[model samples]
Target: MNSLIRKMSMVITESLMSQRTICTNIRFPTFLQVSSPLLAEPMKKKKKMDPQIIKAREERKRKRIEKSIKKLEKNTKQLKPIEEIDWPISLQKQKLLRERTETISQPQQGQDILKAWRSYKYQQSLQETKMIDRISSSQLQALEQLRAISEDLYIKAIQMDDLLLPFTAAGPSSTPPIIGYDVLDGEYIDETPKWK
Candidate 1:
């Protein structure tokens, strides 16, 4: 009876252990079975090329590159001509007609004329300088008078007027503004002559 009871208990324990293991496994979900489309397809076979054909292709590429380099080198030797810098062919053809051959008859007369011109220019410059000085002195005197009258007014006058920035002005027209007149829009035509 003891041996039978022992055998029955051992069987019951083994069944219970298996049940526990199954319960434990069921408690946790299995990992997701992830797969990629790229991995599913079979690998492609590489094509075998001839060595001589490969060398010929390489040689052709090298020759094409060398031909382009030679073309660039040829072009580098010749410079592009600029129209503005080079004398015009029309002007060069008329060079003989434009030449002056006349010589001065009296050098002393020329020197006297130059001296007179220089004196006139000097006098004009002196007059301009004196006028500028007078204008500046008058401005200073006016500023001093303003300061004497009111320091605040003088200070305000000295400060730069920011409102006058990006200054734009329209000149007075000969005709007066017409009230409620409909102005017609005209197309602008450039009449300037084109020079070659």
Candidate 2:
């Protein structure tokens, strides 16, 4: 009897499932149907290569890596030499000749003169600083006055001058130029040494 009941239950469940499937097919037709088949393929087998060839490839790769490492080491060990910093062989040979035989002592007024010079420099620096402060204060006062008088003019005055972008000035020469002097062009030769 128990076996008969189990068989009946299984049949009923199967019938219900079939009914559900039929109802779903009739009532809710699939809106999104896949046209393309699934991309399913067996995994490819790895190709067997010769051991000697593999070893040779690995050896070549290792040699290439070592060559690059050797190149880096060579570059790291070497530094570019500056020509100006190196002492000339001729100057090195004349070291003893260039040495002074007698030692000169400072004069008694040397310290006083140095102190006077330092004081003079300090005074000059103070005067320059004061002058700069005065000029800046005056400029600020002028800007304030302009701002109070006119807003547009003040705004224009505060903006950077584009005309001064390519500023160039010629300083006064030591001697006045001749009234009719013909300037001659001189050839320029570069004496700078090139280093690796």
Candidate 3:
């Protein structure tokens, strides 16, 4: 009797499964006809990219680059050569010292003046003198000391004058400040008028 019930349950389940409906959350893809004589209709062709569209895109890119280059050229000024630079008063003194090093370094002539001049020149330019003849340790130290001396002297000059903007005072000013300057609080001050 148990064997008969098991057989009946299996048959009933199989029949119930066959009778049950299927439900899908999404619609199925419409399959285009591939080929036909016995099955259905004509074959579908794959989509091809147009060459005219690709050529047009490349042309647009070329025009954009040329436009940018033309705009840059229009906005920029012509560059000047290094020799045309008019150095600061401090640098002019150094340049003269460097140019007249032989005359200045003669025996019994003041060697200290040339050293002081070099220091002044170094501070005026705010860079190293690239002379490399392998001098002794003492000479190297002296050169460094001269540089430091000039820098300290520059600071002292500023203190004596009651000055502002140390870098502008030293280096060859790329953009010289006009008579008036804007303060931190948006007020303009005439720097020409000495604050006594």
| Window of ten residues with lowest summed lDDT in model 1 | 28-37
Tell me the lDDT of model 2 at 23: 40
Q: Rank the models by lDDT, top first.
A: 2, 1, 3
lDDT of 3: 0.67
Off by over 4 Å in 2: 1-105, 165-196
State every prediction's TM-score relative to the real structure.
Answer: 0.30, 0.31, 0.20
Greater-lDDT candidate between 1 and 2:
2
| Clashes per candidate, residues 3 or more apart or on different chains | 0, 0, 0
lDDT of each: 0.85, 0.86, 0.67
lDDT of 2 by residue, 96-169 (tens): 99999977757857987999999999999999999999999999999999999999999999999978788788
Pairs that clash in candidate 3 = none
RMSD of each: 27.3, 32.8, 32.7
Count clashing pairs, candidate 2.
Answer: 0
Cα RMSD of predicted structure 2: 32.8
Point out the higher-scoring one by TM-score: 2 or 3: 2
lDDT measured at residue 103 in model 2 versus the true structure, 0 to 100: 75
